[model samples]
Target: MSPTTPHQPVLLRLLHSAIALLVFGSLLTGFMVYDRYDKRFGTLNLPIVPNTQGIHGTIALTFLILLPIFAVYCFHIGDRRLVQSQSMQQLGQQLTEVGKPIWWVSLQRLTNTFMLIAATLAVVTGRMMQEIWLPTGELNHIWYIGHLISWIIMAIGIALHLLMSTKVGGLPLLLSIYHWRIRESDLPKNWLKGFKIKPNSSIALIIEFVVIGGIALAFLLPLFVTA
Candidate 1:
C-alpha cells in the first residue's frame, strides 16, 4: 500500500486571502470614515453606499488588529524556508535561486518591507486622530500630518511595487493569489522563492485607475471647491 502524503500547508493560501480582503476592505472603509469625519471632502460618489464611516471604521480597526498576526504568520513561513536568515551568504544564495528572474532582487523585497512599515504608520496615526490614543482634538495637527504623510508614502510604495512586479512578471504572482487551482509547479517554491513572471492584465489595470481616480476626486475636489 502506498503511504499517504501530507496536505500542503494552507497557511499561505489563507494569508493571501485574508490580506486581500482586509486591505481592500480597509481601504474602502477608510474612505467612508474620512468622508464622514471630514464631509468637507465631499461624497465618494460610490454607487449606492452612503455614510460608510461606521462600517469602515469597524473594518479598519479589525484589519489593524489582524495585520500583525498575518505578519507573524508570514514570517514563520519565511523562517521555515530559511528566507529570513541572518547570514548574508545564505540570503544571496537563496536569492540567486528564487523563482523569479534575477532582476527581482533585494531592492524589491526592501520596497515591500518599507510599504508595510508605512502602512503601519498610517494606521497608527489614523487611530490617534480618531482618539484611540488620547483626547482626539488635543493633538489633531500632529496626528493628521503623520497620517497624511504615511498614507502618501504607502501609496507611492504600492505604486512602485506594482510597477516593478509588472516589469518582471507580476501578473502570475497576483493571479496566483486569487486563483486556487494554480499548481505548485506554477508558483514560487515558497513565499521567498520570489514572484512569478507573466504579462500584466489590462482589466486589472483599468480597475485600479478607475478606483484611484474616484478616490482622488472624493478627497481632492472638495479642497478646491471650498477654497
Candidate 2:
C-alpha cells in the first residue's frame, strides 16, 4: 500500500492561510499605492486607485497582527521546518552525492527561514512608514526604501519557497499544509493540557521573542510619539 502523506498541524495551516492572504493582498495594494503615488522606477498603465494607501496599510496591519503568532509557532512547534544549526554543513554537501535528501531538506529549511526574515523586515519597515510620505512627494525615506526592498525579497522568497517545496515533497506535500483534518492531540482544546508548543532550540526561542517584541514595539511607537 502507498504511504499516507503527512499532514501539517491545524494551527500552522490556519496561521499560514491568514498570513499568506494578507501578504499577497498587501503586495497588490502596495503596488497600486506605488503606482498612484511614486513612479521613480517606472509607471504601469493602471488607473489611479482611490485611497490605495489606506487599503494597503489596512492589509499590512492585519498581517502584522497575525505574524507574531505564526512566528512563535514556526520557531517553537515547527522548528524542524526552519534552518537548523547544521544547515550550513548540510548545504556544503553535494546534491548529487550520498546526502542528497539531507541537502534538499536543508535547502527547504533555509528557504523557510529566509521567507520569515523577509516578511518581518517588510512588516517592520512598513510600520515605520508615514502614509503621507509617498503622497506628499517625499519618496526617499529610508523606511520606504527598506519596505520596498523587503517586499521584493519576500515576493522572491515566496516563489523560491514554493519551488523548493515542490522539489522536496511534490504535490502531496504541497497539499498537506491545506488539509483540514485535525489530529486529537493537536486540537486547540488540547493545547494547554498537552503543552504542545515547545521551543526546539534556544536560538529559536530568542528569535521568536525578538520578532514578536520588535513588532509589538513598532505598533506602540506611534502612540507615544508627539511628532
Q: Which 10-residue span in candidate 1 carries the lowest summed lDDT?
A: 79-88
Cα lDDT tens digits, model 2, 1-227, are 12466787777788888988998998899988888788888889578878888889888988988888888777767788988878777798654663577888888998998888888888878888887798789899888999899999999998999988888888778888888887886688754342346566665666667677777766786687532
At residue 78, give the lDDT of candidate 1.
30
Choose the strongest candidate by TM-score.
Answer: 2
lDDT of every predicted structure (CA atoms):
0.51, 0.81
User: The CA-based lDDT of model 2 is what?
Assistant: 0.81
TM-score of each: 0.56, 0.88
Give the per-residue lDDT of model 1 (tens digit) for 128-182: 5543322233334676667657766876887877775455445665444455554
Native-referenced Cα lDDT, model 1: 0.51
